[model samples]
Target: MNGCAAFCSPASTQPALPLTLAHPLAHHSCTMFFKILLLSAAAFSATTTAATTYKASFTQYGSTDTWGSGNCNVASTACGFYTSPGYSAAVSQNEFGVGPGAGAGPACGTCWKLTAQTDSSGNNLSNAGNSIVVQVTNLCPASGNPLCAQKGLTGTNQYGANLNFDLCIDSGASNALFGNSGVGLAVGSAVQVDCNQWSGEVVH
Candidate 1:
């Protein structure tokens, strides 16, 4: 009749509860889950470590105009993806990894994942987390911008970025990368990825 006796037999003896053993398949599944988690963590760490951080800004060029006059005129782009309809960027000389007057730089046609972090004013941007992949089609000469100078001596930009990326506003991913303004500087990080990762035409 008491709380303990209610559940016990009339003799007030307590019965032992049955013990259930875990199935072999459950152990296997748990091990697999942990293995997958470790692999995913490693992949994320590798991606973060492999990315070369850079400062991002914007440039303007005709997307389809070949006869336009400018360093990055579509037809005269370093990588020759002039008419390609997709994101494009002008990387600084240090990051571009090419010498003066080189027809096509070593960094040309490389794909980069650019994620904005802040605007020229150093304020965190609402679209800061958005990222867009772009193909390198032009060079932002170190002579033109100190931020583009060779490493070691180039130093960081006004926004404190080691490298500078002058993105083209007319590129296909402009809205996604730069938002509506699309005309000012944006601080961001850059990662060189496989060109195949680009969703646009990649002509090297």
Candidate 2:
């Protein structure tokens, strides 16, 4: 069948064929096939598109945002340097690149913009939408955090999140993003973004 002729009859002066008259099901079949193709294309696009923003869980740690000692023993985290004056985070084991036992990985020094959305228990937060950018300075060992246990590219935590950011409260990020409610766990979204003018270890 001439698909172009069927779909673009106005482009030509030739009269359109009356497929419905000649073969009752021809036009219907063509329409159905085109619909199927469109649906398949949409599905393929959805699957091929990599996720840039991820649903994530955020927890606060009461530790100094100093450069050195802690999760990453070197002089300033696994990432090797402190961010700005007080903006650092410990990412999940998988995303931290190196395994729990290692000090660094590919994700070290990566910057992420995190926005608080809800509590760890899924309750909507009063301070939802507050956001902050932080650099990955440490690793949230999966062995220590049950929520960080999710592994591999498709791994997800109990909340169906693939990423976890444990913000250093002393860094001021938690206070800014969650106010007094930043003590424990919170739910949010995380997106990798350009480091821009951020002063920190070279972002990977």
TM-score per candidate, chains pooled: 0.63, 0.64
lDDT of 2 at 188: 83
Instruction: Show the colliding residue pairs in model 1.
Output: none
Q: All models: lDDT?
A: 0.66, 0.72
Screening candidate 2 with a backbone cut-off below 3 angstroms (N, C-alpha, C), the clashing residue pairs are: 67-76, 68-76
Model 1: runs farther than 4 Å from truth?
1-49, 54-73, 150-154, 181-183
lDDT of 2 by residue, 1-204 (tens): 477346633444756665544444655666777898899999998877544898898876654534443333234566665554647788888788777556678887778889888886788888788888887877878886778877874889987788888776756666777775643678888988767624444322
lDDT of 1 by residue, 92-180 (tens): 77777775688678888788888887777878777777788888888778775665764642467656776677666566555667686
Q: Which candidate is the best by TM-score?
A: 2
Question: In candidate 2, which residue ranges exceed 4 Å CA deviation?
Answer: 1-51, 64-76, 197-204
Lowest summed lDDT window (length 10), candidate 2: 65-74
The C-alpha local distance difference test score for the whole of candidate 2 amounts to 0.72
